[model samples]
Target: MSFSNFLSGLKEKTNELKDEVLKFKNKNFLHAATAGSALIAMADGSIDSAEKQKMLKLIENNDALKVFKTSDVISSFTEFLNNFDFDKDVGESKACEALNRIKDNNVEARTVMRLILAIAASDGVFDQDEKIVAIKIAKELGLNPADFEL
Candidate 1:
């Protein structure tokens, strides 16, 4: 193969590697946000269509999360939901595990809390159950629930 051709192939491979690294770096944030969304959605014992739609829109619009393909976000959210459906305690444990991944990062934790609050209120009523779940999430993140008005 010509040197030029080899260089071109190397560049292409490098670009692909960079893309994969970027995805990996953002994967935790994506999972955490989606897991929190699932928790808030299921807080009231029923996931509302409006809440689902709001989460989709948020994923599309949020700069940090928009880097991820929608399919990945949806899949993560679905997995959380399925866990909840299969067993409430297991689901919550899994979701909390994901959330705790970024707990030490104040900025990311606050962002996740905001997304959770938005999802909880999307149904037009941030009910007591939702509030309690949000508060729990806030505490798990080492954040003050009152800071989020939870």
Candidate 2:
């Protein structure tokens, strides 16, 4: 192939790789937000409508969540919310994995924590249980709780 054609092909491949990386990152953020919301919801044994609304709003406003359709995003979130079982360590594991991905991206880590804090305080009061779990998740993700002002 000619040099110009090879360069064009290389640029096309690079663009394709960049697009794929972006998609992967966006999915990672969505999963983290979903799992974090679930953790907050289960903190008090039942997730109230207020907390649910707050979380939904956060997801809606997040650019990463835009990659998913409204229904798809909500479904993922609701599944996590319903399946969250603090009694089992599985929920924590899933949430922590998501959190780690968020933290690895730096900016998303702070954004995710801010969303968590908003949900935790949505009832006008942050419960002890929520605070404890949020702190634990933050620690596991190697995030500073101070960043979220928790």
Candidate 3:
């Protein structure tokens, strides 16, 4: 192939890679999932190491969430926690807003909520606090919390 053709092919490949990266990052989805999970995990007053690990494993194994990098998941989850650590109201509000973005996609929202519930229950004790948070999240996601038995 000529030099011009080689350059054209390289550019095309670069563009394709960029698009792939964008899909993989999926900023909003990652943020919402992580934040929502963190909130539920914190319902018991703190996210135990075991609970955090469970959430990580669930995210890694979950088909819908497997696309995100572990680092990205950790970062998003931590950001929400840090905000919560600083100010309860602010953190909850911000995380809720991020989760609210996916409300339009009901399927995704329900999947995320289910994942949160699993993580909260991972320690073998899904307490009432966690259940309430899940219900709150369900409502925020435009779902009936009662459907989840909240």
Highest lDDT among the candidates is held by which one? 1
lDDT of 3 by residue, 1-150 (tens): 999999999999999897678756567677778888888988988888988899899888977667677987898899999999999899899999999988888888888888888888899998889888998999888889887878
The order of the candidates by lDDT, greatest first, is: 1, 3, 2
What's model 3's overall lDDT?
0.86
Runs with alpha carbons beyond 4 Å of true place in candidate 1: 1-16
TM values, all candidates = 0.89, 0.76, 0.85
Q: Write the per-residue lDDT of candidate 1 for residues 1-150, one digit (tens) a residue.
A: 999999999999999898888889878889899999999999989897899999989887888787789999999999999999999999999999999999988998999999999888887889889999999999988899999876
Those runs of model 2 whose alpha carbons end farther than 4 Å from true positions after fitting are 1-23, 85-87
Q: Of models 1 and 2, which has the larger TM-score?
A: 1
Q: Write the per-residue lDDT of candidate 2 for residues 42-61, one digit (tens) a residue.
A: 78778888988888887888
Better of 1 and 2 by lDDT: 1
**Which stretch of 10 consecutive residues in model 1 shows the poorest summed lDDT?**
59-68
lDDT of model number 2 = 0.77
